[model samples]
Target: EAAVTQSPRNKVAVTGGKVTLSCNQTNNHNNMYWYRQDTGHGLRLIHYSYGAGSTEKGDIPDGYKASRPSQENFSLILELATPSQTSVYFCASGDTGGANSDYTFGSGTRLLVI
Candidate 1:
Protein backbone atom coordinates (compact mmCIF):
# COMPACT_ATOMS: atom_id res chain seq x y z
CA GLU A 1 0.00 0.00 0.00
CA ALA A 2 1.13 3.54 -0.68
CA ALA A 3 1.71 5.55 2.48
CA VAL A 4 2.85 9.10 3.07
CA THR A 5 3.72 10.72 6.38
CA GLN A 6 4.61 14.26 7.36
CA SER A 7 6.58 15.67 10.27
CA PRO A 8 5.70 18.51 12.62
CA ARG A 9 2.03 17.74 12.30
CA ASN A 10 1.30 21.05 13.97
CA LYS A 11 3.31 24.22 13.88
CA VAL A 12 3.13 27.84 14.96
CA ALA A 13 5.25 30.34 13.15
CA VAL A 14 5.76 34.05 13.44
CA THR A 15 5.43 36.48 10.60
CA GLY A 16 8.45 36.60 8.28
CA GLY A 17 9.88 33.41 9.72
CA LYS A 18 10.95 30.37 7.83
CA VAL A 19 9.16 27.03 8.12
CA THR A 20 9.97 23.71 6.61
CA LEU A 21 7.55 20.82 6.49
CA SER A 22 8.91 17.41 5.69
CA CYS A 23 7.26 14.42 4.09
CA ASN A 24 8.38 10.84 3.62
CA GLN A 25 6.81 8.15 1.52
CA THR A 26 7.31 4.42 1.66
CA ASN A 27 5.55 3.65 -1.63
CA ASN A 28 8.56 4.56 -3.77
CA HIS A 29 6.13 5.98 -6.27
CA ASN A 30 7.38 8.29 -8.97
CA ASN A 31 4.79 11.01 -8.34
CA MET A 32 4.52 13.04 -5.16
CA TYR A 33 2.57 16.19 -4.34
CA TRP A 34 2.18 18.88 -1.72
CA TYR A 35 -1.20 20.50 -1.15
CA ARG A 36 -2.93 22.83 1.19
CA GLN A 37 -6.50 22.32 2.36
CA ASP A 38 -8.64 25.26 3.26
CA THR A 39 -12.30 25.36 4.26
CA GLY A 40 -13.75 26.99 1.16
CA HIS A 41 -10.95 26.39 -1.27
CA GLY A 42 -10.76 22.64 -0.83
CA LEU A 43 -7.38 21.07 -1.56
CA ARG A 44 -5.11 23.15 -3.75
CA LEU A 45 -1.87 21.76 -5.03
CA ILE A 46 1.26 23.65 -4.15
CA HIS A 47 3.95 21.59 -5.78
CA TYR A 48 4.63 18.20 -7.31
CA SER A 49 7.47 16.19 -8.71
CA TYR A 50 7.63 13.30 -11.12
CA GLY A 51 10.73 11.85 -9.45
CA ALA A 52 13.78 12.68 -7.45
CA GLY A 53 15.66 15.90 -8.33
CA SER A 54 12.61 17.47 -9.95
CA THR A 55 10.00 19.88 -8.67
CA GLU A 56 7.13 21.59 -10.45
CA LYS A 57 4.80 24.33 -9.40
CA GLY A 58 1.17 23.49 -8.93
CA ASP A 59 -2.09 25.40 -8.75
CA ILE A 60 -1.15 27.46 -5.71
CA PRO A 61 2.60 27.64 -5.70
CA ASP A 62 2.70 31.19 -4.47
CA GLY A 63 4.32 31.70 -1.06
CA TYR A 64 5.52 28.08 -1.11
CA LYS A 65 8.25 26.01 -2.61
CA ALA A 66 9.06 22.32 -2.73
CA SER A 67 12.04 20.04 -2.96
CA ARG A 68 12.31 16.38 -3.81
CA PRO A 69 15.84 15.22 -3.25
CA SER A 70 15.20 11.47 -3.27
CA GLN A 71 12.56 8.90 -4.04
CA GLU A 72 11.38 8.70 -0.45
CA ASN A 73 11.48 12.31 0.67
CA PHE A 74 9.99 15.72 -0.17
CA SER A 75 9.98 19.02 1.64
CA LEU A 76 7.83 22.14 1.53
CA ILE A 77 9.49 25.45 2.28
CA LEU A 78 7.92 28.70 3.37
CA GLU A 79 10.62 31.34 3.20
CA LEU A 80 8.62 34.14 4.77
CA ALA A 81 5.61 32.94 6.65
CA THR A 82 2.42 34.93 7.02
CA PRO A 83 -0.99 34.50 8.58
CA SER A 84 -2.52 33.85 5.19
CA GLN A 85 -0.41 30.74 4.90
CA THR A 86 -2.02 29.13 7.94
CA SER A 87 -3.80 26.04 6.81
CA VAL A 88 -3.70 22.26 6.69
CA TYR A 89 -1.04 20.93 4.38
CA PHE A 90 -1.03 17.43 3.02
CA CYS A 91 1.61 15.30 1.35
CA ALA A 92 0.63 12.66 -1.14
CA SER A 93 2.21 10.02 -3.35
CA GLY A 94 0.93 7.85 -6.15
CA ASP A 95 1.64 6.25 -9.47
CA THR A 96 1.95 8.17 -12.72
CA GLY A 97 -1.40 6.90 -13.86
CA GLY A 98 -4.57 8.98 -13.77
CA ALA A 99 -7.51 9.00 -11.35
CA ASN A 100 -7.76 5.24 -11.54
CA SER A 101 -4.64 5.25 -9.41
CA ASP A 102 -5.44 7.30 -6.35
CA TYR A 103 -2.83 9.11 -4.28
CA THR A 104 -2.26 8.33 -0.64
CA PHE A 105 -2.27 11.34 1.64
CA GLY A 106 -0.59 12.04 4.94
CA SER A 107 -2.65 12.87 8.02
CA GLY A 108 -1.79 16.56 7.52
CA THR A 109 0.25 19.40 8.94
CA ARG A 110 -1.77 22.17 10.52
CA LEU A 111 0.24 25.38 10.57
CA LEU A 112 -0.72 28.50 12.41
CA VAL A 113 1.05 31.70 11.54
CA ILE A 114 1.00 34.75 13.72
Candidate 2:
Protein backbone atom coordinates (compact mmCIF):
# COMPACT_ATOMS: atom_id res chain seq x y z
CA GLU A 1 0.00 0.00 0.00
CA ALA A 2 1.04 3.62 -0.44
CA ALA A 3 2.65 5.05 2.62
CA VAL A 4 0.52 8.14 2.86
CA THR A 5 -1.79 9.13 5.68
CA GLN A 6 -4.25 11.97 6.35
CA SER A 7 -5.44 13.09 9.73
CA PRO A 8 -8.95 13.78 10.98
CA ARG A 9 -10.72 11.87 8.25
CA ASN A 10 -13.78 14.03 8.90
CA LYS A 11 -14.36 17.47 10.32
CA VAL A 12 -17.13 19.94 10.95
CA ALA A 13 -16.66 23.58 11.79
CA VAL A 14 -18.64 26.76 12.12
CA THR A 15 -18.45 29.37 9.43
CA GLY A 16 -15.31 31.50 9.65
CA GLY A 17 -13.59 28.84 11.72
CA LYS A 18 -10.15 27.50 11.03
CA VAL A 19 -9.44 24.02 9.75
CA THR A 20 -6.16 22.32 9.19
CA LEU A 21 -5.70 19.06 7.32
CA SER A 22 -2.49 17.16 7.77
CA CYS A 23 -0.76 14.55 5.66
CA ASN A 24 2.30 12.39 6.02
CA GLN A 25 3.92 10.62 3.13
CA THR A 26 6.66 8.12 3.65
CA ASN A 27 7.29 7.66 -0.06
CA ASN A 28 9.89 10.42 -0.05
CA HIS A 29 8.52 11.98 -3.19
CA ASN A 30 9.80 15.39 -4.23
CA ASN A 31 6.41 16.76 -5.10
CA MET A 32 3.45 17.06 -2.79
CA TYR A 33 0.06 18.45 -3.72
CA TRP A 34 -3.22 19.46 -2.08
CA TYR A 35 -6.44 19.15 -4.01
CA ARG A 36 -10.10 19.56 -3.24
CA GLN A 37 -12.74 17.37 -4.84
CA ASP A 38 -16.02 19.00 -5.58
CA THR A 39 -19.17 18.30 -7.57
CA GLY A 40 -18.56 19.63 -11.08
CA HIS A 41 -15.13 21.22 -10.94
CA GLY A 42 -13.54 17.83 -10.41
CA LEU A 43 -10.32 17.54 -8.47
CA ARG A 44 -8.81 20.98 -8.45
CA LEU A 45 -5.38 21.71 -7.16
CA ILE A 46 -5.27 24.13 -4.25
CA HIS A 47 -1.53 24.17 -3.54
CA TYR A 48 1.66 22.25 -4.11
CA SER A 49 5.22 22.02 -2.93
CA TYR A 50 8.32 20.87 -4.71
CA GLY A 51 10.22 20.13 -1.55
CA ALA A 52 10.50 20.89 2.10
CA GLY A 53 9.75 24.49 3.11
CA SER A 54 8.48 25.32 -0.36
CA THR A 55 4.90 26.01 -1.28
CA GLU A 56 3.38 27.28 -4.51
CA LYS A 57 -0.05 28.50 -5.37
CA GLY A 58 -2.14 26.25 -7.54
CA ASP A 59 -5.01 26.77 -9.91
CA ILE A 60 -7.59 27.38 -7.20
CA PRO A 61 -5.61 28.83 -4.33
CA ASP A 62 -8.07 31.32 -3.00
CA GLY A 63 -9.00 30.85 0.68
CA TYR A 64 -6.44 28.09 1.00
CA LYS A 65 -2.92 27.80 2.32
CA ALA A 66 -0.34 25.03 2.35
CA SER A 67 2.84 24.22 4.19
CA ARG A 68 5.55 21.65 3.59
CA PRO A 69 7.51 21.36 6.76
CA SER A 70 9.63 18.40 5.66
CA GLN A 71 10.01 15.90 2.86
CA GLU A 72 7.49 13.61 4.50
CA ASN A 73 4.87 16.02 5.76
CA PHE A 74 2.54 18.55 4.21
CA SER A 75 -0.37 20.49 5.65
CA LEU A 76 -3.36 22.29 4.17
CA ILE A 77 -4.81 25.18 6.13
CA LEU A 78 -8.07 27.02 5.76
CA GLU A 79 -7.80 30.27 7.66
CA LEU A 80 -11.46 31.05 7.43
CA ALA A 81 -13.66 28.13 6.67
CA THR A 82 -16.79 28.80 4.69
CA PRO A 83 -19.70 26.72 3.50
CA SER A 84 -18.42 27.01 -0.04
CA GLN A 85 -15.16 25.47 1.04
CA THR A 86 -16.71 22.29 2.29
CA SER A 87 -15.30 19.40 0.32
CA VAL A 88 -13.05 16.37 0.37
CA TYR A 89 -9.39 17.28 0.40
CA PHE A 90 -6.73 14.88 -0.77
CA CYS A 91 -2.99 14.90 -0.36
CA ALA A 92 -0.78 13.27 -2.95
CA SER A 93 2.92 12.75 -3.35
CA GLY A 94 4.85 12.15 -6.54
CA ASP A 95 8.27 12.50 -8.11
CA THR A 96 7.85 14.06 -11.52
CA GLY A 97 11.39 13.48 -12.63
CA GLY A 98 10.92 9.79 -13.18
CA ALA A 99 9.81 8.10 -16.35
CA ASN A 100 6.49 7.24 -14.74
CA SER A 101 5.68 9.74 -12.06
CA ASP A 102 2.69 8.14 -10.42
CA TYR A 103 1.14 9.77 -7.39
CA THR A 104 -0.05 8.15 -4.20
CA PHE A 105 -2.98 9.72 -2.41
CA GLY A 106 -3.78 9.84 1.24
CA SER A 107 -7.19 9.03 2.59
CA GLY A 108 -9.16 12.19 1.94
CA THR A 109 -10.21 14.54 4.71
CA ARG A 110 -13.82 15.57 4.51
CA LEU A 111 -14.66 18.99 5.92
CA LEU A 112 -18.02 20.55 6.44
CA VAL A 113 -18.62 24.19 7.24
CA ILE A 114 -21.87 25.04 8.91
Off by over 4 Å in 1: none
Per-residue C-alpha lDDT of model 2 across residues 1-114, encoded as one tens digit per residue: 558899989999999989999999989799999999999888999999999999999999999999999999999999999999989999999997667578889989999999
The lDDT for every candidate, in the order shown, is: 0.94, 0.93
Q: For candidate 2, what is the lDDT?
A: 0.93
TM-score, every prediction: 0.95, 0.95
Task: Tell me how many residue pairs clash in candidate 1.
Answer: 0
Span of 10 residues, lowest total lDDT, candidate 1: 94-103
Cα error, residue 18 of model 2, in Å, equals 0.9
Q: For residue 8, what is the lDDT in candidate 2? A: 88
Error of 1 at 108 (Å): 0.3
RMSD of candidate 1 to true structure, Å: 1.2
